[model samples]
Target: MNINLLKLDFKNIRDFRELTIPLFKEKDVNTPFHISLIQMPNGTGKTTAINLLRSIVCGEILEKEIVLSYQPTRYKCDEGYFGVLLIIDRDLYSLGMHFDYRNGVMKYETSRPKEVGGGKSFSYDLPPYIRNVMTKNFTRLFVFDGEFSENILDNKKTEAETSIKFLYFLDRLELLKIKADTLLENKRKSTKDTKVHTQQGLTKLETEEKKLKQTLVDLNKQLKKFKEESVSTSQEIEDLEKKNDELLSENETIQAEFIEFTTKISSLENDIRNGTNIILNILRTPSQFSLKMNDKLKNLSENMSKLKLPRSVSSEFFKELSDEDECICGRPILNDSIKKKILEKAEQYLAADHITTTNCIKGSIRNMDDYKELSNLRDNLYSYINEKQQLIQAKDLLKLRLDEKDQEKAEKIKQEIIRLSSNLVDLNLYIQSLETKNSAFQEEFSLNEYENINLCQKKLIEKRKRLDEASDTVNFSNGVSLFKKMMDNIISSSIDKIKEDLISKSNTRISQLMGNKDVVLEKIEGCIYVDGKKGVSQGQSLAVAYAFLSTLFEDSPHKVPFIVDSPVGSLDLKVRREVSDLIPKLFAQLIVFIISSERNGFVEGIGKYEDVQFLTIYKDERETGSIAFHTDKKFFMQFHSENEEVQV
Candidate 1:
């Protein structure tokens, strides 16, 4: 499919309102597939016409909806493609593109919501014909302002590539390979991390396991020594009992005589018996002592008793005073001796061997009496009287056991511990060496597992070699021609001819882009540069650039209509005549914007040529809008006659 016609359907388009704007005159079948025009006013929608042409070819403005005098193929290129013309304005206002084509459909979806903060914009859904042709090719052609000359060229490359990518060039081989190469680099990094992490974990595990096994071996040796030393302590205890027996025999003889004397009155009397013995014997005599003396001995015995007392302070006070004084409630005793009487009563019920005696008893006390019974009535007492010596022997043997029985065992345990510890140190060092060996083995094993790394490295080296070879023009014809082909895709051979033909024709028509400065159409390398090495003024630059672009479309692949707004405002007298004649001869269809000031020159130029049409723009008063009309010789003549009457 290709575009057949372009309809200018803006919110307020005056001349083209619902017009099936045929791109060519009805009878001009052999018209050139190009156009040229000159605009005589400054802000007269000259650039707008170019942008609308691009929008139409892009299927932004649907072709089928508009009339076509000649059907434009909607899907295929009638000619190869279209190009852009860049007018330098800091605000980018003068930028414009023009496209020519036909056929099928290309579709696009974009939405600009009615957002609040930014300038409102509307969008068009492109047809598939546009998407197919635009997405694949014909995207790189451009013209630059050429003010900074080389810089503009460089900057345009970037902008052109950006537009192509946004147009979906990445679906093609070039951008696809770029994405794949990025993924390949990421995969290489991931594989490297995986190998490093696995190797690190494996090395740590092997080292720790080796250390643990060596610790277990050292513990086994320690257990062996612990068993042997603990078994020898029993023998040392047996020797202690034998030394106690001999001392026991000598103590029994002396103890027998003492027991015999204890039984006889005179014999026992000659001895200062244990005070306990004397008191107990005296008490057995009974009636000889008064209650006072008996009480004194009882008191002495209780005082001397080794029984532990309760730790209560009230208990101690009650013990000394009995519950005898004041009835314990602070009331005076009815009888003055009542405290003494309560004491006598508590003493009567006192624990046995608590000698607060109301009566005396002989050989009958609590724990003191139990001590004597333990002696077996002096039989074993005498037998064990030198028991201290026996005890000393047993104690000395225990001392020997402390120093010798467990001592030899402990010393052997110490030696065995030392030997085992020394063995452990050697084992530990060996284990360390083994651990180091394991780490080395694991490191080697891991390295072997990732042998692909080496392969990849080798592959990368090979790739670099290939890329280097391919990238060098000396090595490959394709590489040598890569830049040339890229340029060809960017601009067709027709554009180059445009330079020669348009500049040549322009020099013929406009006497070159200078006044009395003899100039020639020159090619510098592949590009056309003006003969003036020094730069021209902004006006001359504009004139030349416009001529350059107009000439570029002269031999275009298909018929293109030209519409220019303000073209003669900056031109000198000679250049104006040249442009005036140049337009109709060079282009097939031409619509120009003009002011009253340049009308005479334009009329003279139009008269100079045979066929041309000029359109007039007016703000219509009654309609409250703009109106477009054609001005002819009869209308001008009528206006001239009316003005003459008003003057008369």
Candidate 2:
């Protein structure tokens, strides 16, 4: 379950005419070094290498344009190659991608372990478990760049949630549920007529079911469209607002006031976001929201304590009692009848596992005593709302002054802002309607049941159930339904458990890297959210992302390499040192693609570790091929790109 990169080779691909970068030191393939820092100056094929690595692992089907993009510019060549050697769990494997630029075709080949006769296959021949989950989305989790940090925080991207599901094999459980649904549908189809229902009734039910299924499909498509449109509209509004701000700043008379207002507004927004996070956290526990619930929990705890509930008698005790000829009280249990009765009663007692779960629940309920935090959170929420309103009024006043200074341009910008804001509002409302669950008595046109995914799904399930009943496949349908419900519950509970554990571990790492507890990760829905800010700096984002990934992969059965481009380029000196200190211990193999500029503090920090291998790759004088320099720390520290070309 541990995968290490052994070597990466390229031929006629990008700037690399021929290259073999050994990821290990002293030719020790059995135990690769923990860190491999490949210093490639800007545009020397760092991105190409990263992309090819992802494509190889994920078995990505290359587009025509992408295939041609890999052709080297140095010479005329119709073919190119990129290959990676990997050691997975002590087994050697190599994956190669053959590119034919003339035909815009890319073919993959993999070599198996020596035990399997060591033959090459013209396909991705990864182990079953690894291949099953090595999706493009999952591969991007480890084989990524600095932009991954920002992507993990975007609300519209499900990278965070999808990674968790895939890593934990929750997606597999979902697939099982889908299989169960398929089985039920097949059973319904096979049973066309039942003892109680005629063929006509069954046919009518089937028609209705088909209609409902189609309705669900259409509703889902509409939902996806709305969600996508919402993201684009939000971006448009943000861009327009930035343009307006720039326009306002151009006027000398209002520039100073505008800058002051912008700062204050930004600060207030952060405050509001933080306050909302705190309130949401406090509200998660219902006892904190109501004094009555708190009292009830307290009373339950007291009663359980008085009654000696979760009694000392365990199933094991009963089991032992039944096994003995005489009872613990010295009663004569030589009779077979007595032993049988005792054995029968054993099932009524709590088992060890149940007792442990009960104790955990009791402890949680016993600890719910304070409601003051909720009251304070409510007050803070109100304060933030009032402050936001004040900031809005101040911004409006500033806009008024700008309008007087330059009416024509100001009015144009103002009108555009107004229009975009209105559109954004409508988009948000529509998104909400699609997500909302409609009640039976709700007006049809206000929010149609078919328009909402939740409601439409409910209707589909009901129709399917009726069809199953009419077709006399009730037993199979019920079994499948129960199985689906069990899977759904497990998925939900697993997500919650993993999220809690990940948040705790990630926050600890974040605190260490940031040197304080100022940055708190409040939740992980589609992405990671900080306690009081809408956005974090690039450095913080990277730190947060690495912390999250490290925690996620800590206990995974598969230990994969972490390949990154410019791992510490965006961070400051202090953060770079912290990251360098923390990242090496988190992964089994770390491959970093860096430029000379990032070597100041980061290289020194990680270079202190003896297990690091440093190498530099740069373009040759003619810019036709790349040159690789295998160097020690001294040389790596002194090396800088002489090519005056700007880094992309």
Candidate 3:
């Protein structure tokens, strides 16, 4: 519904002892202008006019002192009041209030014409919907500054959504949802505390669950450590076994080498002994036999020289002739003296032969150099024996050392290997025991954990059921608050579609205004986007804001005038023109509060539109008083105790 301003009459209003303001003449009231440009200078009762109009439309009670102070000293010691007449949807209504400053009391009254009031007038009888229509939040939509416009356009602002909701009356629905949520939360808390389980039991269970979780975590850590240690021990055993195998192979090679060396030493010792014995016997026999042979040769020479008569005969031949008793003359002399002489002659011949031969052999043996050659051979054999013995001793020592090392170290290694195997067995046994224990613990923990979770979940489910029942009761108690929340959800679900349409329409308006689509407006996750980014300039921001308001108004089921103060003042020339042109089409009656600086741009943009009023506020030169001027105007102005008419 369009709220058309009719007239405002006041006694003792600010800066006026009495004042009457006519928004439209009697003739124009029937043909109200769709647009009106109220040109008001700085601080000339324009703000007061807005406040009084809001009070009249929304039944706001003003303070007596504040109302009296409007006329300065006119009613400082007395009572004062203001009255407003409005034509809403072709129906006439009057809202008036009287202030008693001395008594600090105020009285508000409203009247509908007898024709529309069913033959009875009700004081302050504004309909609830109409009363709801003009609120602080909704007022900002119609009456706001550049800051509000900026907030409306800001993508990051929370108020943007709030303003939209307020404008569309969605805030009421959201408020219901909030109340339902609060009730549900309270019900949940009450159910959790008082249903299915005691608070103490729940707390104790939670604490136990925490401890069990911690214990499980610690056990898992220990299990990991133990497993790692087992792997490490196994690896160590494998490495040691491999090393022991290498050592065993090395020991076998050493033993084999030692045996081979010992065999060679033994052969060398036999050779040394045989060589030494043979050479020593030769040395002893040769030296002793040489002396004996020399003595024997001298004796033979002396005996043979004493007895020899012939040089060719030997002693054996002479002895044989004496035994035969015959001589070479063949004479058989029987006399003893003859036989003896013959025998003696033969012996002497044989002995002389023997002496000569023996001396010749001795001379040849002395020239042969046998003793020097034998001595040299014995010395060489002795040297060779000594070298062989030394070599044998070295071999023996080497064999002994090898045996010692092999025995000593092999035994130690074998013992260690045995001990390592035993230790490995022990570790395996211990690890097995630990694993068994770990398994038992894991099984126990699993069971405990399952039971704990199951019990908690069961209790929680039971409590949640109770809470649901309680919430239903609360909703019943609160009268369809739950239904309203469900409706909110349903509405919320469809908001995306609404937002899509809003985005489409807003972009259309922006495109029409700016003559380009460079700043494509979109909404994502409840935020405005300017070409997929945020924070446009003030002009662009205002353009976006205008587009949003246009969309909101177009979509709203209610019809209301667009009352704005300096709506496009913050905009640049081009944007101001676009906004000025676009706003006229959005609202049936566009009431703009503009100063002189803003007038030319709006007039050039929208002055050609029919039924547009250009009302200028005329301030007295003293600047202490002001009045609105219109060609067709009539109103009541009351003096201290009288009524009058002030018109221009």
Give the alpha carbon lDDT tens digit for every residue of 377-496 in model 3.
566667766776775555434423445665566466557767766766766554443345344644554543323333334445555555455545444445555477577786666566
Query: Where in model 2 is the C-alpha error above 4 Å?
Result: 154-157, 184-469, 473-486, 507-521, 530-541, 626-632, 642-648
Candidate of highest TM-score: 2
Supply candidate 3's per-residue lDDT for 468.
Answer: 51
Which sequence of candidate numbers ranks them by TM-score, best first? 2, 3, 1
Point out where model 3 deviates above 4 Å: 61-77, 118-123, 177-495, 512-519, 524-528, 531-540, 621-648
Q: Give the number of colliding residue pairs in candidate 3.
A: 11
Q: What clash count goes with each model?
A: 35, 1, 11
Q: What is the per-residue lDDT of model 2 for residues 1-648, given as tens digits with 9 covering 90 to 100?
A: 788889898988987788998886676766778899999888888999999999899889899899999997767889999999888878889999999999999998999987866889998888787787788877888998867766777888877888899888888898999899888777667664443245576788789789878888887788788788878877887887777778778778778987887888788788878978877776788887778888888888889899777877888888888888789899878888888888789888899888888888899997664874567767877887787688667765666666555666667767887887788788777777777765642345466557777777887787777777776666566677789999999998999999999999888877876677766777899888766254555455556767888889886777899999888765677677766776776677899998888776787779778888888877777555756656676777778876533222
lDDT per residue (tens digit) for residues 1-648 in model 1 = 222221232212222221222223347532322322222232333344444444533435435333221222322222122212211111110111122224322222232222312222223323333345532123222211123122212323333223223332332545444555465445435444222223344445445445444444554444444434333332333233233322322244433443333334233333424534544564554332345544555565575454422212332354465544455677766764676666565543445344333224323332132112223434433433444345444433432333355445535544555565555555544333323324464465453211223323444454444334333312233332454455445444434443455566645543443454444334323333444446443333444444444444444342334445445554555556655655555444455544545554544665555454333433233543333443444443222211112211
Better of 1 and 2 by lDDT: 2
Q: If the candidates were sorted by their lDDT against the true structure, best first, what order would they fall in?
A: 2, 3, 1
